[model samples]
Target: MAYEAKTKATDSSVLEFIENVESAKKREDAYQLVDIFTEVTGYEAKMWGPSIIGFGTYHYKYASGHEGDAPLAGFSPRKAKISLYFATEDTSREELLQQLGKHEAAKACVYINKVADINVAILKTLISQSVSFLQERYPNHN
Candidate 1:
């Protein structure tokens, strides 16, 4: 199923949840991510779906016949780690990923536990690169 933001319910329970994490480190990581995303995307933070903090918007269709609208770029705070969604399983990001500090890649996203584990400069570059990629792919995304 596709994700939907409950616009009518702008509850910030997600922020509270992140703030109340058992570990101070994790909470700080979340805060840093929020700051980085805000600085780069220029979009105020908001919880999308359930655990994701999304930046921008983009509508996408998969070749496998699935179609949906999603954040142009976003991240999810999972139990074990954080997943940064950028490009899908395409090799277009291969070179960039190689320059990344430490991260795991999935079919459509990049996974990391903490911001300190990776280069903030590189992460910012990836965000910009991914946004550009999606914008070029979907010109009407704005």
Candidate 2:
């Protein structure tokens, strides 16, 4: 399925999400993640996949023969944790993640429970690096 971008402004539901969670800690974490992504990717925030606040975007294809488009790097502020989408798995970032302080990685994203749990600077750098890495792999990505 093709991903659809949010055409309307950031809605009240997202705001309600922030308020309903009622945790200053989580709200602060979401703010930090957004700031980190902006600083690294240099792309302004945009709503993606309903809850995701995405940065840059790129087209991609997996070896499994599945191919599609996705945010070059981004994250979602789910109630449980922050999902950081780097979209590329590169060994070069393995060492960087060690320097990133605290975080966990799934197949395509770095998961953080809170911003205080990780080094914001290193996270920003990693996101930027991942975008560059994917761009090298997919030049048409924009």
Candidate 3:
């Protein structure tokens, strides 16, 4: 059997999803991030799975042979924090995070309480770099 990706793009309305976000502040930030990510990736926002608002698509197969498709850059507004999805493997990930404002970095997600908590410029850089890095590695950008 082949592996399947749970976070595939859906036919959901991105705007509706954001509007349904419980927190007014997070909902507003989600809209702002949609603009920033769209401008940076030059791709329209798409709903990935249930929550993630993704910009671009890429397919990846690791050395262990697990493969799946995911967004080049995206984010989800959870109850606790906004989860920023970017390519952590990118060389500039660390440098960009340094310039980013108050945020906590994890293996794959960057957690921020609000968009105002971080520098938008650095966020844009991180999104662009993530797209570039994945495109190079996967070359199967959709």
The candidate scoring highest on lDDT is: 3
Output the number of the TM-score-best candidate: 3
Q: What TM-score does candidate 3 get on C-alpha atoms? A: 0.94
What is candidate 2's local distance difference test score? 0.73
- State the lDDT of candidate 3 residue by residue for 19-134, as single tens digits: 99999999999999999999999999999999999998998899988988889999999989999999856467888899999999998989999999899999988888889888
Q: What's model 1's TM-score?
A: 0.80
Clashing pairs in 3: none
Model 2 Cα shift for residue 62 (angstroms): 4.7
Once superposed on the true structure, which residue ranges of model 3 sit more than 4 Å away at CA?
A: 88-91
Ranking of all predicted structures according to lDDT, beginning with the best and ending with the worst: 3, 1, 2
Mark the regions of model 2 whose C-alpha exceeds 4 Å error after superposition: 1-22, 62-65
**In model 1, what are the clashing residue pairs, if there are any?**
none
Candidate 1 vs candidate 3, lDDT winner: 3
Worst 10 residues of 2 by lDDT: 3-12
Model 2 C-alpha lDDT per residue in residues 64-118, reported as the tens digit of each score? 6666666777777777777888854567688778887778887777788888878
TM-score of each model, paired residue for residue: 0.80, 0.77, 0.94
Clash count for each candidate, listed in order shown: 0, 0, 0
